[model samples]
Target: MALDGTGDERFYPGYDYTAPSGRSGGTLEVTETAACSASAPTDLAANATSPTQVDLTWTYDGTNNDYYTIYRGGTQIATNVTTGSYTDSTVAAGTAYSYTVRGHNNTGACDSADSNVANVTTPACTELTPSSISFNGVNTAAGDFSGASMVTPVDLMNLEFRVTEGTGGGAPFSQTDNFDANNFGNWIPSDTNTSNNWLLDANTTPSSNVGPSGDHTGGGYYAYTESSSGSYPETYWLTSNVLDGSTYALNLDFWWNMNTDTDLSCELHVDVSTDGGTNWTNSVWSRTNNPNSGDVWVNQNVDLSAYTSNNLEVRFRTISSSWRCDTALDDIVISGPARATEVERLAWNPDPQEASAILTNGNSYNLYARGTDPECGTVYYVGGTTTPGNSQAFTWSSCTETATLNAPTFSPTTTPITGPVTVTATGTATGIQVSWSEDGGATWSAWFANGATYTPTSCITGNVIFRAQGTGTCGTLTAQSAAAAFDTTDKDVATLTTTNPSPATGVVTIQTAVGVETAPATLTGVSVTIGGSSACNVTGAAMTWNGTTSRWEYSWDTSACGTSAAETTVTIDVTGTDPDCGTVVNAVQLTGVTIDNTCVDGTPSTITIAPGQTVGGTAVDLTTLFSTTGNVGSFTYKINGTTVTSPWDSSAYGTTGPQAVTFEVTGTDPDCGDIVGPVSNSITVNNALGTDAGVAGVASKNKQLDVTAP
Candidate 1:
């Protein structure tokens, strides 16, 4: 009210119109929250297929950051379901419920706005055919069969059954109350260790135990008897699909409290069908876990590996027990593609310098030579399943002037073995082809090859010689690498190549081969020495290769040999050594040395019959030749000219012959060094007197064990 430059604290009623300017201010009130929405379907699912359950898919997203505040008409149903769909499987059939969704983020405070209401009704079990199926023990007097015929699955697809037993007048199998739960079918058949033991009883109608259809149906009903006096079979099976190379389990309810069968092993077998319903095979490998209570629902799983396979029909061989038991079956599931290891790229070129790949894992695998190896084009050779998982990698070795995947070959040194033995062949190469025969290539094998990893599938085991061939059409078809023996008892022999200038810590390369012998010929006394002393360290060193002499010597004790072979029988001990390797002052940095023999002197025990010897042949008297009178331990011998490791304890030592005899002790001892002369000796022997005439004629032609390369 006041006005004009008059500074006063008093309120002038008359000068109120002369007010001054002021700043902006307003009310920021929070608005009232929206009401919670109604509930929606919580668990939504879709089973529009044969399953009799309701597949309900509902949503409750009326509001965000909230639960699916669901309601079933009169009452609140599901709450706090954040997913987009909900399946109400427990709904009643033919009856629909109006559903509305409201968001409630666990706050218990649902939205007030209800979702657009929709009604849904549950579906009824469509295939309502009540089924009854069971056994009618065997009949002896009729010499045939009697009792209720089997219930064949005319409706195999979309089929379900409930056991209804009685004096035969039956209703819908499931509705028959006298047959459920506590009760079971009568005259059950038990599987014996038999071919045909469980059959129908003698006194019933449907005299032919099988169904009118005339197929083999196990134990009929009502008129069957129990007989455990003979060795027979009773294991029954109802055809079903469980084999597809898929992981699956047999879900059944079994009750076998009174089991008396000893040769019984209850199993769920799945005979597989791979070819679109043409041929069928068994797919059951190892038996799964045992069946639960023989009468109660028990779930069992079995690896479907050992079963034969076909296209569609997979017979489920249920109980393997000979004792009368009961098992109810349900929901069998098949799942899993779990890959432990898979070779996605298996490409290789004959030329190591070119693009190539090798397998290092020592497991089994089949190398498929693809004409189009993504990068290598269609290769000619492919490998088969490799085993042991450790041979996953291979080397592109060099032979002569060309690169190869082969090991060093050798003629039997020290004691000469049979002639024309294969020393080495390509280890890992493209299109590896190999075959062997003692008949001078008169005939060859189902020769095979690997893609790139030149690991052999079939090994030359016996006296038969082997020759490997690798073809690289892009390059050329290389001749057989080396002739090796197969089906032999010879110890495998091989050489180890090291890194050129090694890691200064000694060289490292996989020892791919061992000399051919029946027993594994271990590389004993193998030591890596520097400066001409036994050492384990060779970390850093330099050496010069004399073009002519090809010899190397270390100047000083570069590094201590940390790597040593003193640990195992197979592993080679490499000394770790490091020092200024052959500098201007020291000269040579690294050198190669041959290890001394560490084979424990074999023992010569009492003479037993030898494998090959005639009654009149020179019996190389074991007592005279191998008597522990000298150096002897537990000894192992070799078949004349094979690399098969024969068991040490022979029931009989054959008569002496132009044959080799070598042996070794069980354990090593400092007191006992490598066996002297293998306690080994050789003598020629003739055939035994009382031999099979056919064997006498074709004894030399006895087939040898086939070699399978890995």
Candidate 2:
């Protein structure tokens, strides 16, 4: 179709070829639709403030008129909110929750796409006051508050904590100004209002300026209350007395209550002074607003350990921003660690510090100390054991020093002590000293170094018990030894006497009697010696109990001295002992113990025969040889240097000339086996009638004839 003309602006359909002038015209039309939609919200975030609540927020390009729809786990939980923030309170604790938000128009038809998913999990409940806790003091991870992952690691080391709780011992000074006493004057006021910090009136209604009806100091009559009339800053200073902070870990506790008619500013400031209140520094408990939750009184802990000085003071101040009920304070307590008292025990040995006290068995020991703190007063201690010989150091947890003492042991505990007994004390250590007590430990002897021997006065009479005491090296601590007993009254002292034989010429017999002064006792043994010679044979039996008459006899032959007549002194010595008594020795002497010679001779007379008389006269006799008093026996004779028979023949002396002849005698005795006498005789014979007689020869015939003639 076509057509176009100058003014007509018409077109004709069949004018293809130029059949032109004819044209057709009608109406022409065009149409389109409007687009209205929204984009997705961006940057979704979530926060779980508590176990059961999750707060969500998001960013979006939507207009102010658009609202929001929050979905949890792909399900809508809240809708049509004007703000981008939402709180879901229906969530469970320790559970993960997925959330998303979409911006939408008020018609709910035009809506943006869902925002990014926000995953959040509530944290588990943690206890504020745990039995123990370990904090590394480092935060090592980045995570949201609601994440379930651990943000840091914790380790526990061996640590000791001393939490002292008390009022007096820890602190050198404290004050509780309830106004009952004039102690309120302690709080010197340089400020304007003095009555603002006084005790609360009894039975008064609670106001901003006063305590509640039941509010009072702990276990006291009234509470210290602060009330102001106008907007004037009120300050009260309470400076503690001088305290030695260097020796203590100081702490304070107080009960406080805050109430305000209007929410006006109230404050409590704590400061420490090292120069006795001349200077001040803020303490850990200083607070501008009342830290207490409500009008009820609460306790708070404050530490002042940082100010460790010998001279220290603590100050408390109360100030207010306007005239309102400020704060109520009650029961202020101050404390610190107590100082340990110094003490020590002395060593058991005196000279060496490493020695132990020796104690006796079955005796109680009294432990004494010399060096101790007088502040703690006199310390009395006693310790004992049945077993002795111990280097024992006595220690007390409250004391600062330790010491030990040595014990002593007594010997000769045998019963019925007949003889003098000696007791000795010994110490386990070198320097330990000892003392003794005999009167049942009633009185003690002076201290003896090392050991000592003692014989008590009661040794012979009554039952006696001995005890020993040991002193330590420091001379402070002492230990007592166990008691030893010696008992019995039976004692014996022996005396000896000797008697010589009656006849001293024969065997000498000696007898000794050992007499006991005390009865009911026996002699152990006895020995005897005679004439300074131990060759004597002695025989005796030990005496029995109560048998004091015992004889010790000895027999010795006097002839054993020599086989000759001699005079000698005989002496006897005896020694004896008893179980209960000591040794007894005695000696006896005999002046004339004559050992007579067994052989003696009488004077011999000369014998003469007129002449041989044919050499046949009666035999001449010579038999006056020996004289013996004791131990005499057979005799022997010798003549002319030759042995002769009894009834001797003088013919052998001959009728010839003169013959020489000698005679001797010897005697034998049992005591003196053989003895020779000093008697000897010489004889000469004249042969007058014999051949030589008258002249030579002769023919004269007179001798031969006369030899037979007489």
Candidate 3:
């Protein structure tokens, strides 16, 4: 308050001193104070709820505070908001948000009125987990060649599966065993034995020369003889190929086995002729079984839809009331619903066949198998460019199968792997197609389609080789995978170095760094132990390796522990053996190692005795006083510290009450520094308590000491 008169004044009584001098006094009254009205930011809820985010929290106590203005749905969005909680990320998922928080007071034009309006409603959209339909199926089949019903190409179906395996001799019916051109005009010339009695002899256990269901292709069947001549209405027919029972549902399926000496006589028939082979009828599927019924293969299925007859001829008969019979037949599957040859999506320009992909030795790949058409079935037949006109449901059945493979069978995880070599391969299939070769195989790398990979950017040394070759559908070159070898040379590993940093006992120089390249990797073994005995003694020639460094010269003998003070801990084992990767051993160990020969006699042990009188000894030669400068060799006689190793008299310590004598003084010279004295002394033997030096009253506590050297 220095108003010109140099006076620091302070006395308030409602306008005086300065107002009275301005001529216009008496009317000079000022009252102005308006800006900090901030105190309205309490509670404003809505902690968290996400679909799009809301989380808005409030609570401010008014320190004249200035920032905070988050409103959503009501518009503002966020102005300053000096920290409380305001997430509101544009809110929108099931909408309904309304947050408000105000606390201005610092020029946003006086605020502090809107503090509670946080009604949130966002969360309501979270449902994701419904995807599955993967069937690339390389070999597809998982169920079809005996692996039952697992069609891939998205639903394929021209569905025809025929297997014969008959021909014990051929010429009874053709197509391997009749049925391809009608082979039964009725045989009976000498009782039928065209090839070897009509086929059906390979004998595969109780009835399967082969062909149970895997759609057979190589095993005998089809033998139907019934002619001991007891002939009860002789009948033998075998026909088929007039089809059209209305197509598509024709199912025939077969696989039977039989042999009858004569019981029920033998009758296995399934007929339906609309008068082409000249009338034949007897459906109800017959089979009699008797005559020891040995062979047992049995697998049948015949609906034929009741034969609406497009002249439908389908028969297989044999009726003989009592005679020597034999009736067999292998896989005959007729299947219906045509239109199914989609093999299973195959594309191989550079698909996945690269892992360990090496191919070239006899490389010749031209695999192409495009077979697609059963988007679902029934389509009657339509060309394909993208469905020209075919929609009974779906059916085109594109067909093409080509395969050829000559080189590809190299597998590698590590065949001397040191350089750039990432090879992989393993008998792959399912419309196969692969190609790879890294040099030894000559050249190839680009026809992949089955989990492939190849890595060869730099390193490849010595016998390095890799090969692979696989072509479609199991044909042409078929599929190969077997040539992988890598040998990156320059191998040797063993590291150990020592020249006596703090060792003792004697000669110890064992070095080994190992880099070996231009021939030199046979160290083969060298050791040096410690605690378990045998600490050095590897003399001349069993170790030296000079390609980079490898040596062993041990001879540390501490004389068994003579001068008392021999600290030890030395170990160094090494073994290198890698001559072109033959024995492959690379080891190195250096353990503990701190061998000091005990000889730096000094410091840390002070107990010069004389602390509480005790001189009634029968024996207590405890002498410890390390102060002669240096070089000490023996002196360790503890009584209460527990190490009594030299002429420890007093009859094994018996002069009772108060005995704590100590002494220590190591240092035999091989750098055995530090260990002067467990210098503590205390002895109160109080001996002399006996009863005649022997028996009687039994209190013979022996002691025999004299005590000197204080």
lDDT of 3: 0.43
lDDT of 1 by residue, 351-462 (tens): 1222112322222232211111111111112121111111112122222223344422334421223333334455444665545444433454555443212222232333
Q: Score residue 204 of candidate 1 by CA lDDT.
A: 24
| Error at 622, model 3, angstroms | 15
Residue-level lDDT of model 3, residues 1-710, one tens digit each, is 22343333445544545423433423334444554578766577885465656787777655766688876533365788787777875554554444567778775468776665555556665324211111111222110121111111222233222111111111111112322332433222222223223323343322223112211233433444434434454555556566655433366766555545334456677777766658677754776543233334445667775565556667677665444455656556554543222222212222223212232222222122122223212221122321111211111112233433343443345654455434444443344455544443334566666445554433235333333334445332233333344555444433444444245444444554545434444445544433422343232224555543444444455434323444444444555554444454443455555554444334333223343333333333444222333344455555565676543454433344434343333332223444444445344443455411121122223332222221
Q: What C-alpha lDDT does candidate 2 achieve relative to the native structure?
A: 0.47
Instruction: Please report the TM-score between candidate 2 and the true structure.
Output: 0.25
Name the candidate, 1 or 2, with the larger lDDT value. 2
Best by lDDT: 2
| Candidate 1 Cα outliers beyond 4 Å, as residue runs | 1-338, 347-391, 395-461, 464-710
Provide TM-scores for the models.
0.15, 0.25, 0.22
* Cα TM-score of candidate 1: 0.15
Worst-scoring 10-residue span by lDDT in model 1: 137-146
Q: Candidate 2's error at 263, in angstroms? A: 3.2
Give per-residue lDDT, candidate 1, residue 652: 39
- lDDT agreement with native, every candidate: 0.31, 0.47, 0.43
